[model samples]
Target: MTDASLPARFERPSALAFLGYAAAIVIILWSFTGAGFSIDKVVSSPPRFADFLDRAFPPNLEPQVLARLGWKMLETLQIALAGAVIGITLSVPVALLAARGLIAPTWINQIVRTALGFIRAVPDIAWALVFVVAVGLGPFAGMLAIAIDTIGFCGRFFADDMEAADKGSSESLTATGARKLDVVACATIPAAMPAFISTSLFATEKAVRSSTILGLVGAGGIGIELKVGFDLFDYPTAMTVILMIAVVVISIEYLSGWARTKIIGVVR
Candidate 1:
């Protein structure tokens, strides 16, 4: 209870930790300089942005334009849904292999985990570019990109969730002479299902956002429309595209959050 027995208010950082902090600060400053950070530009950006707002205020709300954008938005949703389904389906097997102490051996688990990490490290846009080359510029390419990206996103989380599942059930099943796959199907997967559902919902949301930009690389979505608008300096149309994208993305996010909460609550 004495002052000497109480923990120190602030422990001094280690020499290595201090050095790491200093190095981080230096790197940040170096990056800012390299990236041309400028207070003058920041201070003067408002008028330029205001001018852009003036040009974009009258959103191109023509009925035909709205219909076209609506169709494209629907296509974007389709891409996201199809890709999410494929990726989430594939993630199960991939995660089974990646999960330590699950179906795959430690060596196999490490390799699969490393592969998933590599997949995740590459941006979805980069994947879209690659798929565009392979599949010839369309929603198919965008779907493939979203699928790969979702697999990468969901696989890691799925593996971790499986690995963290209540081992007691698996152990009991094993004691009853159940095979590894049986134990996984009945015990491990069931235990991790809630987390899997939550993760899948997030993957869908992510796919939607990624799909929109995939069109920029000719991977197919409304991105091409946005690009064309900007290229032609059609600011009004560009603003409309931006607004449509915002609405769709926000709506999907809200729905995903609601689904996740409901499902998780039911599970709990």
Candidate 2:
């Protein structure tokens, strides 16, 4: 195609884009004012932070403390694992149901999508608190919260992947004697499997991070221990716990990312 024959560009910035930017700026300014935000206070807070950090020096990385950290770390992992598994199990069907490629029924797809959206709308900590109320304070609450969060994350991920999958394969299967479920199982699911696994790993990493804070709501994990150290004015111990959390989070992120990358490589 000649330059003149080439289609017009779709997204040259226009008044709508300018208006959106203006609205965003206004909203950002309003948000700061509404929340009584003060950049000056933030700048002034560094000394207080420095003092706190100074007090947190020589973290109590004693053998006993490290051992406790190891145990709590294991508990956090277990909670994340349980939640990821449960969330994957629950999310898969909803994802399949919401996948427009497989499910042509608009109402059904909308319903499933809306339900997943509702779950996704709630923050992990809020859900943790709710679960703590329902299940009592323990890793159980953390597990439930993580599960809900995973469902929220992975469900949408899976559904979007499924929707975007090559409909040709699934359509071809449907053209044969395949049932709707068979079409999805044989074609759509397989096409999206790698993406689903990768997304699930991402969600699992998020769950692990969130699990630390869930303990604040009595969801059972290292967070409770951290809170305890903080409440006792044990800055060294709290710092230790914080370091432990950072270590685990980084470790999980690296490990999961490596695994996902390897899997993608293998699949390709």
Candidate 3:
């Protein structure tokens, strides 16, 4: 094809494009002002941060404190694990309903998609607060919040993964006199299992991180300890809690990554 026959590589942006860009810039500036962004505060923050570090040094090493924190951490892990399992289990069926042209009708798919979106729109912390009020502030409430959050996280990805699975195998199953559910069971779900596992691992990691802070709202975990330490100016204990949370969260992330690689590799 001659250069003259080719389409132009660059064209002037439309007036609407310029208007959109200007609007984006204005919104950013407005957000900065609304969020109370201050150059002076940023410049003056170092000394205050240093003071925090000074007071937080020499983390509490008391055997009793360690034992107490250990139990709380264990509770947090339990909450995360139980919640993730429940959510992931529920997500499979919900995802099937949300997967367009899978086992569910178009209207069912739309409804399920909308419900998943609504679930994801609300923050997990807000869910925790709601559950705390409902369940009277305990590990159970935290677990419920994590479960709901995981459902939102896993359901969306699971549905997309199933929808993107190899259509050839599913079609073959359907053409062999298989029912819609049979086709999904024999072909679609198997094809999407690896992605489902990966998403579940990610959901578990997220639940762990969220559960750590759920205690701040009295939903049960090390967060309550951290809050109490800060409230009483027990910097050493607070530092210990912070360190523990960091270690656990990072460890879970690394483990999740390793599992994803190994499991997906094996599946492939």
Q: Per TM-score, what order, best first? A: 1, 3, 2
* Model 1 C-alpha lDDT per residue in residues 1-268, reported as the tens digit of each score: 5666868999999999999999999999999999999999999999999999899889999999999989988998899999999999999999999999988889999999999999999999999999999999899999999999999999999999999999999999999999999999999999999999988988999999999989999988899999999999899999999999999999999888888878787422
Tell me the TM-score of model 1. Answer: 0.95
Off by over 4 Å in 2: 1-20, 266-268
lDDT of 3 by residue, 64-96 (tens): 999999999999999999999999999999999
Candidate 3 has its poorest 10 consecutive residues by lDDT at: 259-268
Q: In the order shown, what is each candidate's alpha-carbon RMSD?
A: 1.8, 3.6, 2.5
What lDDT does model 3 reach?
Answer: 0.94
Give the whole-model CA lDDT for all candidates, comma-separated: 0.94, 0.88, 0.94
Report the Cα lDDT for residue 172, model 2: 89
The window of 10 residues in a row where model 2 has the poorest summed lDDT is 259-268
CA deviation > 4 Å runs, candidate 3: 1-12, 266-268
